[model samples]
Structures are given as C-alpha cells and as structure tokens.
Target: MTRSEVPSGGPGADEYDVIVIGAGPVGENVAERAHASGLSALVVENELVGGECSYWACMPSKALLRPVTALADARRVAGAAQAVGGTLDASAVLERRDGFTGNWQDKGQVGWLESVGLDLLRGRARLDGPRRVVVETHDGTTRTLTARHAVAVCTGSRAALPGIPGIEDARPWTSRDATSAKEVPGRLAVVGGGVVGVEMATAWQALGSEVTLLVRGERLLPRMEPFAGELVAEALTAAGVAVRTGVSVEELNRPAADRPLTLSLSDGGRLECDEVLFATGRAPRTDDFGLETVGCEPGSWLSVDDTLRVTGVRGGWLYAVGDVNGRALLTHQGKYQARVAGAAIAARAAGVPLLETDRWGAHAATADHDAVPQVVFSDPEATSVGLTADEAERRGLRVRAVDVELGEVAGASLYADGYRGRARMVVDLDRGVVVGVTFVGAGVGELLHSATVAVAGEVPLERLWHAVPAYPTISEVWLRLLEAYRG
Candidate 1:
C-alpha cells in the first residue's frame, strides 16, 4: 500500500488520500482507480458492497427473467416443451439470486477492497462539509474522514413512486421487493410499463402469477420507438401478460380479506391482485447526503463540469459520478463516469496536466447526457442507442428515418420459423452519419454494441455500409438499414 507522507488532520478528520461514498459499481471503480494510482482511499457504504445492481435492480431481476427468456427460446424448438412437465420455480430462482448477490454480505467484496488497500468503512455516510464525510457505522460509532485529494459520490438510485391516491400508505413492492421475494405473488399488478415493471411482470407471470402491466401512456416503453413498443406489447400479450396501456391507476384500495389489493382506474375499470409492483422510474439518492453544505440542494442532483468536478466545491476537491449526477442511472455508465473522474483526480494530484478526449472523454459523461444505450432483457428483447427521430427533430436536426419490419432480415428468419420483430435507424441527413438505432426481436442484445460504436465513433453511413455484419446472424438488419438510407 502506498503511504502519504503528509497526513495532517483537519476539521473532524482522519487522514486519507481519497474518500469515496457508496460502494456500488461506480464507487468500487473509483476506489480501485485511486488505489491503483498509489493513493490511500476509504469507501463508505451503508448496504451491500456490490450495490443495488448486485442485489436488487440488475442481478436479481435478470435472475428472475433469464430463465423465462430461456424457456421461451426452448419452447420455440420441436420436442422441447416448457411449463408442461416443468415450470419456473420462484423460490429456487430467488435462492440462486441470493447466492449470486452473496446474500448481502460484503466479505467477498471486502476482500477485494483489502487486496486493493482501500479502507472499508461499513456505514451510512453524509457529507459534513467540503472534504469532510461523517459515517455512522452499524456498530454505533461515528467517525469523520477528511479527504486530501477528492470526495466522490457514486451512490446509485432508488425506485421512485409517483404520487397516487393512497399510494404512500398502501403496502406495495418496488423493484427491490419484486426481485428479492422468495415467493411469487398469486396475482401481480405492475404499475408502470417501463423496463423494470415490464421485466418483473414477465418474471412473475412465468412463475405462475397472473400479471397485469398498467401504463399511463398509450403504449409501453415510450422511451423506445413506437414499433418496439408494439413488439413488446405483442410479446407480453402472447405470454399472457395483461397489458393495460393508456390507463391510469387513479386509486389504490386495500382489501380486508382475499387477494388484498385492488386498483381503480381512470377508465372505470378495476384490477385486483395479490400484490402490486411500482416501476414508475428511479430517482437519484441525494436526499440525506448533506449536499447543501457544498452548495447543492435536495431534489436537485449534483452539478458536475466537463471534468466531473462538483461545480462549486473548493480546491477542486469534490466530484460526483453515477446516478447521483442524474445522468445515466445504469450501473455500467456509472462505472464509466467513475473511471474518468478517478483518473482525472489522480492526474491532478500527481501535478500531471490531464490529457483530454472528446465528449466521450475522461470526466465528461457526455454519452450519459446524450446518447446512452439501453437494453431490455425480455423475450424478444429490445436494444437502442442514441437519439430517436422525434428527439432529433426536437433538437432541430434535419433527420431522415428508415423503418423496416425485422422479419425482412435474414437474421430474424434464422432465429425462429415465425419470427416477428421491428427495426429502425435514424440518420443525420446533414452529416450522413447514423445517429440512432433500435432493434426489437429475439436475440437483439448482440447487435447493440455495433450501434453504440457507430454512434460513438461517428462512423459515416458509407463507411458503415462497408462494415459488414456477420452472415446468418440477426445483425444483418444493419445492412437493411443502410440500404434503406441509401435509397
């Protein structure tokens, strides 16, 4: 471990080179970067070390859904039947999920921290002031740590429940509850047709819960192309997921007896379920972290400059990454931000002038602010990158779009005998470069990285045309998209 020679204490301080708050993927990357650069770093975390992705949001939800997706694929084959002699075991899945998440234990993660020489402070941390963090440990002692170089916040996000009548007092499940539950609800009503809600609904539906997905919008996944939403709706309907788009849950009522829950809708219909899961959206975890002491406020996220520096902090000693910055809430994007901020901090500390990259440079999180890629790991999955046509037009770009039935592609044909899918690509007419791409069908996740690279690299359509997608693969949609653009 590298030692700092000038370890002088300041206000309510214990000496450290860097102090990282939150032990999520982003925070872990920040600590690892700091330690790798020969700086003493301490990580303060209140929950499991691997963060929400490990236990609730990403990992467990995928655990619940993966088997369903696999089963769907298997059922497509001859003589490979599903849900006949075999059904999804919710308890076994949850048990396997717990094992994957290490049952909320930090021993394995703490071992990694120790290997990297990072001081592990297992507690909830609040920003006392600039360069000062106060942690109240589970053991009941409070300790203050002063950071010499920087204090980086990477605390992830939490499920945000939109204000509805009786929602606050009503017992409900969020992504956390839906993913961690050992038993599937008898009948589940998912409020919100976004990624998390749609995924959990499918999982529970496969696990023998009659699932209903309610959405206020006219279609599901309003964030993606309308065609993609149509595909998802079709898949959900086929799998017995009762999708209620263009409806609002006006009131949530509790029952004293059987089933226990019911929803009154604006459309004069009621949905009864054993449990309800809310996947309205996620909000940054910035409330109790004392952001005001550093000139930031609650409800608003931390303001960061191109270099990932907290805009108003003194001596360039404060940084914020991940969901707390209110950029991309995905775990991988957060880790990307942490890498940039960590490297920038280390370079600044060593008196080395930082070399900068473009919008995707170290520290900017430019991609998060603009073209972030997202994937929904559902049956007939959807993947997207960059700005859609509507967004481009709103941003004053003269955009041209090509929409193709995914079934037209050779790749879709290979995936299934009766493959149904949709594909769309948005192009910047002025620059003749691909700006956005969306693919919805079976096995589409494998196609997103190419789209990401195109958007990030600004690869021109002519050049991209020459970049051949592998034959007998779902990725041949790229060729179809480019040809449509050419015509």
Candidate 2:
C-alpha cells in the first residue's frame, strides 16, 4: 500500500475484482459502481488522479471563459452597460482561473477517491493478458495484478496536431497550454475553428490579445447550424478578432524558440505572432496500453459494444469508455458512458441478469446514437442537443426544421439590449417528437438541458406544449419554436 504525501486512496489488495486504467472521471465512476456492488476495485493512474477535464480541459477552459461571458452579458443590458468601460482585468481573471483549477493540485480529487473507498495505485498500467494488468510504479517498480471480472480502459485523449512540416518543432500550444497559460500572448494565431479554437480565441482577445483565427472550413462552428457560426463570427469581428476563413497553413517557421514565428498561409499571406495554437483534433491515448498483448491495436481507438465492453477480444472482460472508445469526445458524454459501463460491469460481476441495454437501457449509451449535447462558450454562446434537421434527414427521418430569431422571444429582448441570436427545433413528423434543438445567443447554455430532456425522453410535442415557460425568460423561445412547427 504505497501512499503519497498528498494522501492517496484506499489499499485493499494487490489483486482486485476490477482494475481501471487512467484515473479520470470515467475511471473513478467505474470504480465507484463496482465498489457499490461489493466488488473490490482499484485505479491505476500515472499523473494526477483527476483527469484532463478536471485540471486542463473543461475546468480551466470554463474558468477562463466565464468572466468574458459575464462581462459580455452585462454589456448587453441597458443600465448595466453604463457601468461597464475598458477591457477585463486580466490579472484578476487569471487569478480566479488559477483558483478554479486548484493550482494544478489533486488533493480534493484524491480525497474524493478515498471517501468512495476506491483504491488508487500511482503507476502506468497496461494489459499483460486476459484479466491481467502490469503496472510500472512511479519509483521504477513493476507489479502484476489480476482482475477477476473486468478491466476498463478510460485513458482519454491528447490534442492531435496536424501533420505539417515544422509543426512539431514549432512547439505550438494545445488545449492544455491554452487553458493553463500564465500570460496572454501579444499576437496569437489560432489554427482550426473547432470549439477549443474559437473559445480560446474569445478568451484571449477579451484578456488583451491580438487574435488571428485561421479556419480551413468555410465558417466557424461548422458542426452547429450555419447561422450560429455567422452570429459568432459577427460578434467576434465586432470585438476585433481576425477571423480568416477558407485558409490553410502552408508552413511554420520559428527561428528562435522564444520569439514569434512567421506564419505562411496557402493564400499567399503572412502573419507573425507571439503564440500559435493547434486546436485541430484529438488522438486516443492508447499507444502504450499493451493492447497488443490482448490482440488489440495499441495506438488505435478501442471498439466497444453498447455496453462499452471491448468487442474484438476473446472474452468480454475488457471494456473501453469515454474518449478512448471513440464514441463521443465531450466530457459530459464520456461521463454518461462511464455510468452505463460501470453498471454493466457490476451486473456481470454479481452474476445478475443484465438489463436490456439495446437502446435506452440501463447498461447502454443510447445518447451517443442521438441526443448528445454540446456548448461552445464563445461571445454569443452556441449550444445544441441531439440531431440537426440535416442530420435527421441524413438518417432518413422525415423532419421539419422550424427556425425563429431569438430576439422575438419576449424574455430575450428584456434580458439584453440587442440580443442577436436564433433558435431551431427539428421535429420528427412521423414520431411527433422533437429530435434536435439548437440555440445561439447570450445565456443559451442554461436552456440546453431542457432540450436534452425533451429529446432523450422522446417527449411528444403535445406534452411539451403544456409545459408553460416563465413570463420573461429565454425558455419562452421554446413556445415560439413549437408554434412555428405547428404552423
């Protein structure tokens, strides 16, 4: 039972019923569920017990964006706009962000693990064989452990940079560097127009950075409604962000490690900037999980069934959840899969009859098929759940997409002086239920879960019509959308 000065979790035995690799939120939940089922569980982690979302990705990113969003909200109000002047206090904002991240500390997470009675082993874990894992401890000691029931792989992903010349040597910032950056760069060139790119661009621009957003796509937030990107780009341009669309990077040259690099673009353009950020995509962290030992590819995303149990293996003892499974990349979606996978593991261990996990079952990740929610916390805030009209049509569902300007909502005009936004509700004509919902505007994030409930519960349009919204709130937009659908 090796423990750190920072206090690690439980110490039951070298062997346990279940061993989860990568002590992220998903892994913790898996161990928790197994423990609740009277099965001894342990987690093997190489870094901080809390995963990327806790320290680097979600927590820090949201912390940095909150002040910017709040001030923007204040600026849009009539009386409140009078009090607002000048830019945000960068020092205060960074300090608050630091506090939110716990200064890269993991004591709180470690304490939570201890409370849950889940054992933690600080080591790099990999599969040795069926129901077996080999862990290399921090101090250069290797130990082999046996799992009686299941072994779950919750190792998430890392920022995947593009395969361009001089990209690696350029040492550009990824999401981790963007979230934990101590000082805002003077001139920042953001590559890729995904959530990380736009959100970080918004944050740094607000915190006093000359931002150049380079997007290979035709517009920003390409995954959302087209107008969502149009509105966000308008707001960003108004705020003085250089949003260059339909552009590609030809090459990057940084002569000095500490100095700005000259950016070469495919459009015969050049810009020198203090920092460059690559928010391109993510790659699974399965390169060294010893998947080869179990006849699985080491560096590839693990394939899993509805229950999150690894499919290609001989026995169903191996499971992959979260980003590693390549299902959905969002933290909330990963956590959702974690809950379902954990319940499945517990049921299989106790020899109890597993619940029907076909679509929306106890052990199934049905939301991954549809009803996945996402929010990009840029200036105007774009949020959505389930499918868009195009997506429903692609899946062969006869659907009607009803669109309405958010300013028409009584609460939106009352909330902000000039609230420029849009809302779309995709209704399945055959099913008479809302299949997808999208909202873009100030404070639309709060209205997202209501849509999630509607889509996940398959709530009929008739039922939703009776759910009266408050007198003056953004939620009143739902009434307008439903009315548009009826018309």
Candidate 3:
C-alpha cells in the first residue's frame, strides 16, 4: 500500500511496527531494514531527511575539498605542474558544493523513503513513554505515534561550543557554519585540531582565506599516530596556514556583527580574525525530546548492546543508533548499527532467538569495536583501521609494529614524484594476524579497505604474503610491511 493509504491509529495518531526518530541516514536505514523484514515503519524528521552529512558535514565538506586536492595532486607531477596556471575559482568550487547538497533540499530523499514503502512524517519527535512518541509538526499541530514492535532514536549529534568567557557573544562558527557559509571569511581562525578543524582549515585556506589554526593540544590530529599529525602540519604550513599549537582562546571580543573578532589566547597573545570556528567537539542531540519520560537522561548519550538496543530501558523495545549512541560516530558505522538494530527488532517481534552472544552474528554490530576504518581528508590524508598501536598496547595485546615509507615503494613513486607517506602494520603476536594498520599520505584513503579486511577478517601473516599486491600500486606497501615484519 502507498504511504498515504497506510491505516492510522486514530484521528490524531498513527501506528507502525517501527517508529524511527530522525530521518537521517541512520534512521532511514533502520526503517528500510525493518520494512524489508515485513514490518511497517514510519520515519519522523525535523530538518531535511538527509541530515547533517548531506547538508553540512560529509558531502558538502568533501565537495569543497576535492578541488583543492585535485589541484595539489596536479602540481606535484612535473608535466602537470607546468600545465597548472592559476588559483582555484572559489565561486565555481562553492557552486559545485551547492550542487552536491542539492541546495539543501530533501525532496529526493523523501521520495526514496516512499519508494522503499516507509512512511514519512515531517516534525520534531519526543519519546512520550514505552512505544509512544509525540511529534510537534512544523504547522504547530501535534500527533501521537505508537510503535508496535520498536522505537529507534537516531537523532544524531550537534556541534558543542566550549564555555570560554565571551564565547557566546562572539558569534563564532560551528562546523555547520564552516561548511555551509555563503561567503568565505577573509581571515579565518579555526580552534581545535581534530578532523573537523584540520579539514576545514585546509578547505578555507585553499579557498582564499588566510587561515590560522589554533590547537589547545600539543599537535594536530592527536587521535592518530604522531607522524600523521606531523606530516599534515608540515603540508598545511607549506600551503601558507599558520598552524599554532599549545594554545587556546581565553576570551573573544567583537564590537559589532560587521567587526572582526579579537581573541585573547592562553599564551598571553592576542589576535584578530574575520571569523572563528569552534570545531572543539560534538554533543548528542538529546537535550529534549522527552527522554526523561522514558527513564533515560535528557541529554546523555544512549548506551546500547551489540544489537543496538538501549540498555536500562525496561522492555528492550527502545533502540538508539548513530551518533546519539556515541558508537563510532561515522555515518557508515551508524548505518551498520541501524541494520543490526532493525533485524534484531524484527526477530524479537517474531519470537525468534538471536545469536546475541556471537560477535560475528548477523544481528550484531561487532565491527564497531574490532574494526572501524576512518579517513581524514586533509592533504596528506590519514587513514587507519582496527586498533592503533597504542590502543592495542593499552588493551594488553602482544603485538609487533612494522613501518614502511611509501616513497620507497615503486607504485607510490609512480603515483606521485617524491611521494611522502608512511605505513604501519600492527600484528597480534599470539594470533599472527594483523590487528591494526595506518596509512598517511596523498590518496591513501582508497587503500584503507584492504587493511580493514585484513584486520577484521583476522588474516594471518603467511596467508597475507600470498595475497600479492598488483605491481605499480600503493597496495605494494602491504608486501613491504610483511617483509619488514619478517625481517
């Protein structure tokens, strides 16, 4: 039946097998998976159905960075360097980014929901009680929704601004403003050194902004290997970004909306910029929405089991997926959780037992712990899968780390002249299998999946040695790492 023809609960209410709050990618996946399992589903969204990734975070940011990366790649090659003449056309780049975001429209996403036989409700949803939700629609009307089987919360997260004095009045930019701004600031000061800070610094600097990157920590991208941050910092410096470390904003001052911002640094230094971005961190978007009514904290990240069912909630009928649950906040991982949660919900409703204890079970999101792959799209891209060497050591695993320079590899040299990159493979000594892998360089993002497979599949060293990498490719780094491990 068409979504419109679906039977309603009553005059001002509706009922479905699954009610997914937040029509972002995670929620959409949950509803689709549940529907595919023969359960009726309804999705409620307050903003665009595609959420932050489509409008402000992933798609638009990547769209803005691709041109910068392409130009940098061409300039690295000899013949191509001669052909490259001018700076990037900022206007054209912005237009391309706009195209990727579909100008912030969600019609296409809404249609996809209908095609998949999932109903859409445009409103802000709050948990009323077990299996019950109250929605505040844009038109100021209220409607109650009841889930017969499960209620999934996929509300995701929002940018968290720090509590520095005067920060509230300074009107600084969050990640959303950084990616979706209509006009680029002449002088941009970025606070924080995580993925968001570095990526936005790279994009805005290339797009004609004099970017000053301020990091409260000792180095940038501190979550990765030290060398990863070192290489990216070196590249950003060469590209004219003023990378500052061991500093933070003590205070901020702006006399008027048109005036530039004055920042007081903890290091007893003062600076002025046309704009400042606080990419400090993200907080779960669970401030309201009546979580307290369901015995969950109003603004706390939801804790969930492997099957994505919320812990401590009475009936195990409430699930939390995506950033709201704070498990590997990447989009792909959240969708993975969504699929697992949907299937588990459907199986439980049908009185079917789940392989809950099995790590590799179809309804378990085991990859969230053992193997999570991530790529930082900055120049000298950083990618890693599974555990970091430090992480493995902290977990008390007996492991050996093997390192290789990408410039020494034939394929890497051919890929770019004087290719400056590093690769590290951490092998679990007891199991003789790869537990972690890190690659930092230009175009290394594409090489991540092989490492992901190796770590996740627990492929042994001997077996990996026979899995030959094709000649003249970055994949050769795998062979070098293995040989180094043997030596």
Give the best candidate by lDDT.
3
State TM-scores per candidate. 0.93, 0.97, 0.98
Residues forming the 10-long window of minimal summed lDDT in candidate 3: 1-10
Q: Write the per-residue lDDT of candidate 1 for residues 1-487, one digit (tens) a residue.
A: 1132112234544768899989888899998998899988888888877888988888888877888887787677555653435787778877888887788675777677766767777778888887989888777778878888899988878888878887766678998999888787788999998888778877888889999899899888888888888888889999999898889888887855344777889899988888889888888888888887877786567778766788877778989888888777788778878888888889888988866746776645677756789999878898899999999899999999898888878777766667888888899999988788898888888889898989877898889878988887878888888887778
Decoy 1 TM-score against native:
0.93
Q: Model-by-model lDDT, in order?
A: 0.82, 0.90, 0.91
After aligning candidate 3 to the native by TM-score, how far in Å is the CA of 195 from where it should be?
Answer: 0.3
Residue range 207-279, candidate 2, lDDT tens digits: 9999999999999998887888999999999999999999988888899898789889989988899999999
lDDT of 2 at 313: 95
The alpha-carbon RMSD values of the candidates against the true structure, listed in the order shown, are: 3.3, 1.9, 1.7
TM-score of 3: 0.98
Evaluated at residue 63, the lDDT of candidate 3 is: 95
Segments in model 2 whose C-alpha atoms lie over 4 Å from true places = 1-12
Q: How accurate locally is residue 289 in candidate 1, as Cα lDDT from 0 to 100? A: 84
Question: Which pairs of residues collide in model 3?
Answer: none
Measured with C-alpha atoms, the lDDT of residue 216 in candidate 1 is 90
